[model samples]
Target: MSILSLQGVVAGYGSAPILNGLDLALDEGDIGVIVGPNGAGKSTTLKAVFGLLAVSDGCILLRGEDIANRPTESHAGRGLAFVPQEHNVFRTLSVQENLDMGAYVRRGERAALLDRVFEIFPPLKAKRAQPAGELSGGQRQMVAVGRALMSDPSVLLLDEPTAGLSPLYMSELFDRVVAVNRTGVTVALVEQNARQALGIATRGFVLAGGRMRFTGTGAELLADPDVARSFLGG
Candidate 1:
């Protein structure tokens, strides 16, 4: 069964719609990558799923339940977490403190969750006392992701996690994404690095004009001549 499904979804910021009845489904333990041009509604899709935008039509199903119009705060407890592309962390807060904030909605012990987060992003462990603003871009990204993990979400929505990083950091971030997925969290990510993002994806979606133009396995999309020429820069 699909863990998350978007059926004929239409969403937008105001009256102008970005997603035009888009459809997508992601099974459990899948790393789904969305890649497309700048205005293709890639980020909008994540926003819709996270309930940050208004959906005028259709529904977003999480674990077979309709969660289309729910508020953003309501998502975390339902096993959904989202990390936006920028300004994701509390710059003034310490690393540990930032993670603690992520767990504010939880009523259970957070120590184990913190340990797991540190294990996933080991660099965070050594700098637990440092301010998030002081970390490098990649480490800050880790903190952002780690903060989301503190909520113990079953599905993670990442909007361009590798947005402003050096090539080395981008590669390392992808590796960390895979590591996170390996631990059974379903991942849906939007990325500008088409080739690299699709390289690690279990399922790849190519969007154009706010609609999916192509959908396939990562290897299948990578191997397609048309997909390579149009989206992967040949």
Candidate 2:
């Protein structure tokens, strides 16, 4: 069964709707990528699922349980984590401090949790004492993702994780994401680099105008000429 599923979900800003009956499903241990142009409601989908936006219609389930309209704080303990594209890290805090915040909900085993995150982001381990704002963009992104992982979530929701970074860092970022997936975490990611994102994804979801344009395996969508011409920059 899917770890996360959205069915006919409708949401918007104060009644000005953005998502119109969109549907998506993410399975356990799968890397699902959502890609489309700007205003395609890519980030909005993550927000809606994370309870940042009101759900005007439809259902969002976590392992078959309705999570629609739940509070953001209520989600953390339920094995859900979200890393937004911008302002993801606590700039004022040190690297280690930001990660520590992620584990506040989990009172015990804090030491082991820190070790797990540091292992994944070695650079973060080296710069644990440095202020998060002093780090480069890519490092900050790593901290953002690492903080989310600190919660030990079952399903991770990433919003434009590779938004702005050098190609080197971007490649490394995706590698870490894949590594995380390998360890049994389900991932739903929003990305602008459709080619690279879809390349690693087990499943691809093409969002356009707040609705899904296509749903299939990564290879299948990449092979589709129409998908290539439109979303793949052909």
**Residue pairs that clash (backbone atoms under 3 angstroms), model 2:** none
The Cα RMSD of model 1 versus the native structure comes to: 0.8
Error of 1 at 162 (Å): 0.5
Q: What's the CA error at residue 183 for candidate 2, in Å?
A: 1.9
lDDT of 1 by residue, 1-234 (tens): 899999999998789999999999999999999998889999999999999998999999999999988998899989999999999999999999999999987748698889889889999999999999999999999999999999989999999999989999999999999999988899999999999999999999999887889999999999999999998999
Taking all chains together, the TM-score of candidate 2 against the true structure is: 0.98
Global lDDT of each candidate: 0.94, 0.92
Task: Tell me the tens digit of each residue's lDDT in model 2 across 19-68.
Answer: 99999999888899999889988999999999999999999999999999
Taking all chains together, each candidate's TM-score versus the true structure is 0.98, 0.98
